[model samples]
Target: MEEVEVVVAHRDCATLRVGAVFLKIDSDQSRTEVEVRAMALAPIPTPEIRWREPPVLALAALPGRALGRLGHPETASSAAWVAAGATIRKLHDAPLPPFPERSRADLAAEVDGECAWLLANDVLPAEVVTRNRELADPALRPWTPVFIHGDLQVSHIFVADDEVTGVIDWTEAARGDAHYDIATLTLGHQTRLDDVLTGYGPGLDPDVIRAWWSLRCLRGIRWLIEHGFDPSLPGGEIDILKSRM
Candidate 1:
């Protein structure tokens, strides 16, 4: 066996170290990665900024050969959609006994603060800011909150041989409405969600799904306004939000 050396050491709230592997890694490590929660900084109303801890999951690096050389495929098969839904269900069912309790109002306040900062920094257009406020104004009803992987997207997911092997990046994980997670997935996949839910099995209400879809659109709009429009975000996403306004 050869010794591996660290080639990159990147640190933010959580630390990530990439190294050269000397030999073949096992499947278990690839299947089940380590999850670490780290404390991150968030500005508050006070003169001083506060530290808030967010969950961060560590993922094993994929082998060079296994890496996808092309962008996300435009179409996913029905089976692939089902597989993605199952992966999300497993994540939603994960235990988080020590997670902090937060209300919908609390989340709205957080979003408001973020929007304010973005506007102050001239990151978003005035129209976008106004639209965000309108969408965030609706009082969110109290529902059974679950452990949501705040930023669930295709780029953060690891798939091999058409199976979702690992879900990565938990920096945004929190106890919130399940609709948030559903929305995140929908925004990333767009029109393909119908296929996903088809594989998502029965029992989900059509009304609830529609609600989740609306919330997802709102969240994506907020993200784009705050972070500036990234070329990578789906064109349909921007169009949907504009249409909603």
Candidate 2:
């Protein structure tokens, strides 16, 4: 048996320090194959992403490699999209605890702190933040939470032979509206949405999906404004948000 090699240690989402490894395994053909491993090294005593308590799991390892860079766009067959959607549906269907008693205003206030930092740093234009606050819909937000893969872009989705082999990065996974997960994917990678929706099955409401999409856009914009020219932010995303605005 071979051991996994730790390759890198870095911080993710400004909260968790991630230690990534490369595991060597023997293939059916008696060849060596390398698999990636990721685990959370430490918890941010003061997490900026949200005001949740400590995470349940201390570490998690994904089964496959991240696809290229984060948020890179890729064209997929409708069949592929359906597969991704089905994957999401399975994740959403899983059991999760209910959301905490925080009001929508409370959530907004938490996010406002991050926005304030971005504004102080000049990472985001004041106009953009004001517009986002004005457009926020408290009622549209989910009161009861479902399982959400906090970050669900193409990079977090792993593929093998044109199929989604696994979903990675459960560190940010939490109880939220199902649409939060769906919206994250659609707004971050709209090109593959048709397939995602197709795989999500027939019971989903288009209106709900649209609403989530808009919310996802807002979320992405906030991140970009905070991070300022991050490699993770896609060019198409800026274009999409600009068009909408």
Candidate 3:
């Protein structure tokens, strides 16, 4: 019998791994459309599309292991992290996808909303949330947008030896602040950042990246909690917020 594993299940979407194929079932058809389109536009390797019908997108799993899980140490070599960075550089250099506009003001409002939820729910201590909010203020400044993966979590990247084999999950892909991708990649694995930056080349502002780190952590906590995932997991969302202080 072929093994069938549920990768994740939520009101918005569910992902399943069966044998060598993965099935993504999204409640929103538009998100699936954007994902398929983004994968086609990315300059780097992405999962091969097997079939698409309505809300279900079947993809052939890519070669190699994931770079790492979120909120955990990455066992992949520093070179692999560097290669991942180079892959992102290539994607950012590609033609921008025609996604809807994303504004810093919109992001600030979202952050403010999520932060409010966190405090009201007591998801994180007030001081932690307040400090990270202050840190995130700098990232609210204007930036030159680029083609970004939108959700460049480490698990989305796959690697073999020292090369990036493919990147998965493009639903959130958009033309947005470049630091968003960079910050997403190095969210919990700060130690691997030097290697990634080396391959990403120069002129990236450290403050912006740091600020995005705080912003993403704060922005994601409420959603994760509402979705039934525990953000309090060790080295998870809460840890990411504390690390920014």
List per-candidate RMSD values in Å: 10.3, 10.5, 1.0
7 Cα displacement, candidate 1 (Å): 13
* True-vs-predicted CA distance for residue 233, candidate 1, Å: 6.1
Clashing pairs in 2: 81-195, 146-176
Candidate lDDT scores, in order, read: 0.49, 0.50, 0.89
TM-score of each: 0.59, 0.60, 0.97
Per residue, candidate 3 scores C-alpha lDDT tens digits across 1-245 of: 99999999998999999998999999998888999999988889999999988778999999999999986666899899999889989988888889975898899999999999889988888999999999999998887778999999999999998999999999998889888899999888878788888889886787888898999999988788789998788888898887766
Tell me the TM-score of model 1. Answer: 0.59
Predicted structure 2, TM vs. truth: 0.60
Which parts of model 3 are misplaced by more than 4 Å?
Answer: none
> lDDT by residue for model 1 over 1-114, one digit each (tens)?
544454322222323333421121222332112223411211100011122123323334542121121124454455555666776776556664245657777766766676
Tens digit of lDDT per residue, candidate 2, span 1-245?
44534332232222232443222212121111001111121111111121222221223444444433435555555666577788778766666533233355665676566557646766556776555444444326655565566667666666544566666554455566666666666665555566778888765555565555544554555555455545224544445444444
Residue 173 in candidate 1 has what lDDT? 62
Q: Candidate 2, which segments miss by more than 4 Å at Cα?
A: 1-9, 12-71, 97-103, 115-121, 138-140, 203-240
Please tell me which model should have the higher TM-score, number 2 or number 3.
3
Q: Of 1 and 2, which scores higher on lDDT?
A: 2
